[model samples]
Target chain A: MKIGFDAMGGDHAPVETVKGAVDALSLIEGEIVLFGDELKINKELSQYKYDQKRISVVGTTEVIENDDKPVKAIKRKSDSSMVVGMKALRKREVDAFVSAGNTGALLAGSLLKVGRIKGISRPALCTIYPTMSGASVLVDAGANAECKSRNLLEFAYMGSLYAERVIGINNPKVALVNIGAEETKGTPLYIETYQMLKETDLNFVGNVEGRDVPSGKVDVIVADGFTGNIILKLTEGVSLSIVKELKNQIVKNSIGKIAGLLLKRNLGDFKKQLDYSEYGGAPLLGVNGLVVKAHGSSNAKAFMNAIKYAYIGVESNLVAEITEKIKTMPAFEAPVENEEENE
Target chain B: MKIGFDAMGGDHAPVETVKGAVDALSLIEGEIVLFGDELKINKELSQYKYDQKRISVVGTTEVIENDDKPVKAIKRKSDSSMVVGMKALRKREVDAFVSAGNTGALLAGSLLKVGRIKGISRPALCTIYPTMSGASVLVDAGANAECKSRNLLEFAYMGSLYAERVIGINNPKVALVNIGAEETKGTPLYIETYQMLKETDLNFVGNVEGRDVPSGKVDVIVADGFTGNIILKLTEGVSLSIVKELKNQIVKNSIGKIAGLLLKRNLGDFKKQLDYSEYGGAPLLGVNGLVVKAHGSSNAKAFMNAIKYAYIGVESNLVAEITEKIKTMPAFEAPVENEEENE
Candidate 1:
């Protein structure tokens, strides 16, 4: 299998991406194609030893910066690593593509260039959100801001399949993220979605509140992009602030310094669980090709993890499975209205 | 001013509520009316040494459970402490009411019994959300699941007033909690709310994302009840899991135990900053009467904080100011034609 990695992506590009590709070569059997400026890519690759036979470089002329407009950038920057890498995926030159550049550009390039899976209205961004029990798939973590009830139903299907196929959980419990657990809780959208999900053959759990997201009561939590974005980013912000506070508490003075050293191993373990690299990149599910949107500021390790995640997607035939499932499922119909207010 | 205390409310009722009343007697210069079973309230109060003249008891027979339906509980349980206290406020026998019982019940009782302030279409639940800098007022924290542009416009007004008058901020920066910072970033509800807020005289900042909520970039953040509830509950959930994880880390081993002891003071301060009791209870803004809903699991100190919050609202005439502000707001007109989708 050929996995394409964007060498001109992320804050630490060329250097980190090259190193990450080399690092990932040892773990997987797939060939890694680096897409970027060849001279710079070779220079970075020269610093690393071994894995020459497994790695190849596809030279590109431009790069997509964080500030660039997603759709406009993709259309104009044809020679950019992101657009070039996406093109490779669309042409079947690579099994999967990974990038740690502008998320909007990646998503736009995926949809506008690579196109959507058959029968899928919109592709949802899937993130592996860390929870107390383990982790769960947060579908549409920030894809479509406004969504129809049918869209969330699609997310549930995709998220459930992702949890089982890529992330490796069987019969993943699926839930609708709502304001409350009651059948009548949430906005008109969520209440309607809840009724639709209840009828699905998947292990469909009823409404789960925002609080239940962290409690790890459900394996797959689906919501519209706005709510999902809030939940996803809020977790990130709160976790960061808490981590900063804990660090301060551990290294303020003489006694704290001693304590920090004594508890170093445990702290390291704690940090590992919450680390971005540990979870890998988010996959744009329901897209025609395997595309992963890595965090913008990913380091070498995080970039490598994204490549590994891409390999998992390709190996599992995630795209084909989703197409088959969508093709076989009955056409979506809006839930019948009964109660006015949910909660 | 008479502050009606729901003595039969909260997880640790009678004992905690009576103690909270005694605690507030020394801080707030107001009479306290304890509403519940007079026998139980007095029995709990007899242990505390307090001035007899400052406290009074009124007997009520019914109690609202946490599981009870909000509207039904308020309508049927007329003799319940929540209902009785709200009745007292409506009758002008008390300046404000404090309860730590069922939130929905308190909200329903506040609306049904005391009614909305004149010119206000909805009563917003105001939470003094803790931030990195200090705290800000979160209007419509979870009162109405769905809302119109007018409802949010009023929330901005009430939230700004709460920040300035109660929280002691000068010309607080009010922002609409949205999916993005751009003009066309959010759903129709937020985009229209943004347009309406821009026309107001308040210090209205344009738009803020979910991550901005914890960053403490804006003072008053407003959203519809569904989004508001998700943000509020999600914050609570994430903060809780972090705290739990921290506690586990601090108590794991001998070195960790030493570290825990050394960092106890700084950790204590951090916990205090995020503590619910330190910030006071959420007041139902736009209600004709001042009603403070304390946390369901509030102890004596948390209850006292709610009473103190109600005292501030009464002293500042929060209800009257909001009523006047609502009366002067431009009639809400939905945007004629624009983008339709905002999830």
Candidate 2:
């Protein structure tokens, strides 16, 4: 097995990505293929001592920037690390593709380059949301801005399958993110989606409000990408602000400074639990091949975890399971027809 | 001026509500009219000493429960504390109405009982979003679950006016809460709303993603209630969880416990900063009268703050200002006609 790593991706670029790939080699038996500028990749690779045979490079020239238009970059920058890595995954040259590059570009590449599963209407971006009890999967984190009830139904099944297969949560509890717990709540889309989810074979746990999201009571939270994106970004921003505020409070007084020193180690651990890097990356589920999008500002550790996450996705055969279930499931078949009839 | 208070609202009921009213008397010049069970209001009020002449009780037999259907409760329970308080506000018997009661009932009563300002399409529930710098107003927090582009335009104007007249911000930066920073991003509704905002006299700061919300870069965030409700609840939940997690981390070991003791005051201050109670209540904007919806689990401090917030609203003549501006604004006029043409 081989994992395609975008060495030119993330804020740290080849430095962090190369270091992360080298560190990750010890944990997996699979080989790592670095896709980026050959000289830069090799320069960073030389710093670490590793089994040289297990690591390889497929150098590319163009780099898709953070601000680059997602689809435009994917189509235009053919030799870019992201596009090259995506092509490699599509061709089965690599089992999974991992990148900490532009999230929009990666998602666009996943659909345009790697393509989608035959039965899936839209592939969702699913993230591991760290919670008090454990982690819950937040689907369609930022893929589709507007969604239909059919799309939400697909996200629900895909999210549930990912939870069961990759995350290993048995009979994963799937819940629609709504303002109220009742079926009557939310817009026409959510109301329609609620009825669809209720009849599914999956373990559908009614509705959950935004407050219930971090409680980890449910394994999978299904939301339209617009709402999910807002949730994703807001959670990150609020948590980050709180942690920064804590540091400020700690340095305010002489007594607080002393307490900060004594509690530094515990604080570090607590921050780690809240950190996005600890969760690795959000998987672009329902894409024909496995694609993992690490945070754009990822460090070496974060990149390493993302690669590991991609490996887990490949090993668990998440894509295949979703494809099979979506094709065969009776619940999945009805929504498409119902939607068409409505239109 | 007189303020109508729901004595039988919220989790703590007459105990907290009556105490809050008593505590609030010294902060304002207005008389307090407690509307609920007369015996229960007096029973709790007797525990506190105040200017007896300033505090009066108007006994209402019915009390709107948290679970009661909003519109139904407002219509059927005419003698309910919420309904009665709303009626008093409509009739100019009270300058404003404040409650820590069923939010849906309060919002419904504000629209159905007190009514919307003339020419206003809809009244939004706008809340004070506590941020790192200070606080920003989040409009349509949970009023209209679904909204048209015109409603959002009104929300933007109303939210901006609330920030200026009530919150005392000069030329408050108004922004649309969207999935992206781009005007072209988001659904067609948001795109249309974006163009409408740019044409207005408002200090339109362009689009803001969910991450930019807590940064306090903008003074007013305009969104559909479905999205705004999620943002409101999620912010509250995440902040609460972080505080709880910090407490757990502090008590996990002996060294941490000592640090926790020394840092307790700072943590307490930090918690107070994040506390929803500190912000008082979400005002039902665009309504004919001032109606503030306090938190459901509000204690005396929260309820007291809500009353003070209502007092400020009355003093600023917020409802009158909004009513006047909305009628004169050209941006407000165009969209209503455009929507009609499309239909």
Candidate 3:
């Protein structure tokens, strides 16, 4: 099996990306293709000695920056590392594709190049958030904002499968992220989605509120992209702000600094718990091929983790399983109103 | 001025709420009607002695629990303290109403008893969030889900007015909460709201993302009720989790415990900065009368703060000012062709 890595992606591109590829290749038995400028890749690779047979370099002339628009950038920069890597996945040259580049570009390329599964209307982004209990998967973080009830049900299905297969949970609890836990609480879409999820084969846990997201109340939390994005970002901002304030307070005085030193070991554990790098990349579910979106600022460790996640995605045949399952299942049909004599 | 307090509301009920009211009455020149069972209020109030005439008791037999359905509980339990307090506000017996009861009940009662402003389609609950640079207001935190663009515009207008009048910020920056900062980033309603806000008299900052909510990027952040509620709850949950985890870590080991003791003062300052009690209660904007909804788990400090906020709301004539402003302003009209129509 082979996994394609966009070696030119992320803040620490080529160097950290190459190092991460080497680290991943050493641990996993897979042929790895690092797609980027050949000179840059070789220059970074020169400092390390590894199993050369396990690694290969694919040359790409263009690069996509963080600020570039997704679709426009993907179209104009055809030879970009992310696009080349995705193309490799589409042709079955690689088992999975991973990029820590422009998320919009990666998502756009995943849909346009790799394409969506036959039964899926729109692909959803599934992010694994580290909670107090464990990690939970939030689907459609920013993929499809204006989603129908059927789309939400699909997100639940895909998220549940990913959590159970990749995250190693059995019968993972699936929940709709609503304003409140009550059945009647949320918008029309949430109420309808709640009813739809109840009939699904997955372990539907009913509605879970925003506060429950960080508490690890459920394994898979699904919502429309708009609400999901807000939840994900709000959690991130609040966590970061708290940590920032705590650090500021910890270093304020001699005694406080001493307190910080005494609690350094535990603080390190807390930091690790809050770190997204510990979890790999967010998967763009419902795509025809496995596509993983690593963080934009990902370092060597994060990239290595993303590669490992890609390997797992391939081993589990996640894309094939999702596609087959969706195809066989009854297509989500919008409720029809029978008009008897109105005509 | 008179302020009605639901003494039986909140986690601590009559004890904390009554203490808070007494504290406020001592500090400020205002008559507080403690609306609840007279015996319970008197029992809690016996601990404090100021002037007996400054504090009065109103009788109520029913109590609304946290788990009860808000509208049903409010409708059926007419003799509940919450209802009785709101009735006082409706009858002009009190200048403002304050409650830490079921948030939905407060909102419902506020709407039913006081009614909406002449042109206001819906009332929004605005919560003041503590940020790195003090506080910012988030409107429509859960009052009205599935709002049209016009409703969002009103949220922006009302939120801006509240921030300006109550928070004392001149020309407070108002931003529409969205997934991205770009004009076309969120749902069509957000895009339309952005356009409407730009044309308004307020200091309309462009789109603000969820991460910006806690950063104090803008003075006022507005969104439809569902998204706003998720953002508000997610922020609360994340902050709570971090604090809980930090406390656990601090007390985990002998040396850490010693360190925690040494740094307790600084930690208290940090905790106070993040605490919601400092900000008081969220106001139900667009209602005919001033109403503040305190946190359900509020302590004496929080209740006192809510009383102060209600005083400010009343002093500023927040409801009257907003009601008159909306009357003359051109009402928000839906775009002839929504952005989604072209897409």
Output the number of the lDDT-best candidate. Answer: 2
- DockQ numbers for every candidate? 0.59, 0.81, 0.70
Clashing pairs in 2: none
RMSD of 3: 5.5
Best by DockQ: 2
What DockQ does predicted model 2 obtain?
A: 0.81
lDDT (C-alpha, whole model) for all candidates: 0.85, 0.88, 0.85
Model 1 TM-score, all chains together: 0.93
Tell how far residue A252 is off in model 1, in angstroms: 4.1
Q: Which candidate, 2 or 3, would have the higher DockQ against the true structure?
A: 2
Candidate 2 on A1-343: residue-level lDDT in tens?
8999999988998888999999888777789999999999999888889999999999899999988998889889999999999999988999999998888888778877887786677888899988877789999898888898888989998999989988899999999999988899889999999998888898999988999888889999999999999999999999989998888888899999999999988888898889888777888887889998888888888888888888888899888888898876555555342111100
- Model 1's CAPRI class is medium
Q: For model 3, what is the C-alpha lDDT against the true structure?
A: 0.85
**TM-score leader:** 2
Q: Which docking band does candidate 3 fall into?
A: medium
| TM-score versus the correct structure, for each prediction | 0.93, 0.95, 0.93
Better of 2 and 3 by TM-score: 2
Worst 10 residues of 2 chain B by lDDT: B334-343
Q: After superposition, how far is residue B138 of candidate 3 from its true place, in Å?
A: 1.2
- Name the runs in model 1 displaced over 4 angstroms: A328-343, B332-343
